[model samples]
Target: MPIVNVQMYSGKNQREKDILAVAIIEDVSKILSVSEEEVMILFTEAPHGK
Candidate 1:
């Protein structure tokens, strides 16, 4: 399993997060030669400069 961590400022909505998840799954699946379901993504939201 491939674990990916993504950090961003805390202001994104559900749609944006969904879009990012889809895109990340696609690219990671291709790059890692794994299925979309096998890839794991962790989204972290924090204030700027944290």
Candidate 2:
């Protein structure tokens, strides 16, 4: 199992994040020979401090 943590500035919509998460999970699963369920994804959002 692998834990995927994505940290970025808060701006993207939920749909975009969802799509990216799924894409990452699929690629990680395929390359690691693990099931999608075994891959854990966590997204951390922060302000740009602009």
Candidate 3:
């Protein structure tokens, strides 16, 4: 199982997040020779505030 963690500044809409997730998953699957279902993708959206 391939686990991927992505962190980005919070400002993306739902569509953007969905697109990003799918793109990341596809790339990881191809690189690791694993199915998209087998890959784990995590996105942490953080605000630029204290």
Identify the leading candidate in terms of lDDT. Answer: 2
**Of 1 and 2, which scores higher on TM-score?**
2
Give each prediction's root-mean-square deviation over alpha carbons.
1.8, 0.7, 1.5
Q: Per-residue lDDT of 1-50 in model 3, one digit per residue for the tens?
A: 99889898898998998898899899999998999999887889889797
Give the TM-score (vs. native) of candidate 1: 0.88
The per-prediction tally of clashing pairs is 0, 0, 0
Query: Candidate 2, overall lDDT?
Result: 0.97
Worst 10 residues of 3 by lDDT: 41-50
Per-residue lDDT of 8 in model 3: 89
Q: Pick the candidate with the highest TM-score.
A: 2
Q: Estimate each model's TM-score.
A: 0.88, 0.94, 0.84
Ranking by TM-score: 2, 1, 3
Predicted candidate 2 versus true structure: per-residue lDDT over 1-50, tens digit per residue:
79999999999999999999999999999999999999999999999896
- Judged by lDDT against the true structure, how good is candidate 3? 0.90
- The 0-to-1 C-alpha lDDT of every candidate, in the order given, reads 0.92, 0.97, 0.90
- lDDT at position 15, candidate 1: 96
Give the range where candidate 2 is weakest over 10 consecutive residues by summed lDDT.
41-50
**Residue 16 alpha-carbon offset, candidate 1, angstroms:** 0.1
Rank ordering of all candidates by lDDT, starting from the highest: 2, 1, 3
